[model samples]
Target: MSSTKDIDALIEMMAKLPGLGPRSARRAVLHMIKKRALLMIPLSDTLQNVAATARECLNCGNIGTSDVCDICTSHKRANGEICVVEDVADLWAMERSGVFKGRYHVLGGTLSALDAVGPEELRIPKLMTRIADEHITEVILALNATIDGQTTAHYIAGELETRGVAVTSLAQGVPIGGELDYLDDGTISAALKARKAL
Candidate 1:
């Protein structure tokens, strides 16, 4: 048997993680092995604990250690607006921005006919329930700028319009310090359409 067989298996599993290729995973595994006493042991323990307790929040679909995530349970986050995102990663990204003070609703994924994803498969029905139960005044669609994302946004907008709630989308524009030459035509057009008075 190969002496490094177990370590190789660990590296292979780590490589399957997003953003970590074989080379990166090999380096990470080697580093963890070298720092076993300091980093590896603690990391292993933490991972085990998280694997045991991590769960999806029943109300909003955010992953947490409990049935309801901290944001969903917080009274301070019960603002009149709910920002809907395509996934938990998007929700985490929005939270990292610290610009939005309201709660979030994760849709799991965009509506993709190819993937057979539909509103029923996502948390759309729950979002409607939240709107009525929470007395939400506005819904901010923060989905990605993909075709499926836009389709999902439009579908949700149409649904909310009939319920008499304001539906808005995140403005598409060139990023701060981004040059016009580097932008796509659709981005340029969207920026132009959403231009504000100076």
Candidate 2:
């Protein structure tokens, strides 16, 4: 009986997206419906096209419309360094920062003992192979600050110990523009420990 059942279903589906809640999804759905010709149709077409063609890159584990993503195929990015990340989302975040010029290796997910995830489950084996095949000189770990993320980073560092490649991790400390009063004890300690000459 609800005449708006299909619209309700659409709102529910949109709510399942990362940051949108039910209220936001409803607003979005209504807005799209109001702008059906201007916004909804183009978005629907693009979504359909992307859903049909999106594929993970075989070389770097990045999602694209091809087997190998543009980053992996770009010669300018072959800087003998590979930034290792936990997921495609992490890889995308790093790319958006525009700081790292080298290629990347997405592990798919961090090693989780509780979840029964291991190196085999991730792309660790592929990473090791890439080190040798691509003549990689350095590997920068950009995992999250969570317990599982740190555990996975340590494990990867151990694995790369004998691989003749320099292994480093992203700096962990106070964030830029963060106030000292609002900072955690661990963060303050890390910032002090990593203090520079300036």
lDDT of 1 by residue, 28-87 (tens): 998999999999999999999999999999999999999999999999999889999999
Model 1 error, position 90 (Å): 0.7
- Each candidate structure's TM-score, on Cα atoms with residue i matched to residue i, is 0.96, 0.96
- CA shift of 10, model 2, Å: 1.0
Q: Which regions of candidate 1 are displaced past 4 Å?
A: 1-3
lDDT comparing candidate 1 with the true structure = 0.93
> What are the Cα lDDT values of the candidates?
0.93, 0.93
* lDDT tens digits, residue span 1-198, model 2: 253879989999999999999999988998999999999999999999999999999998999999999999999999999999988989989989999999999989889888999999999999999999999999999999888999999999999999999999999888989999999998899889999896
Error of 2 at 169 (Å): 0.6
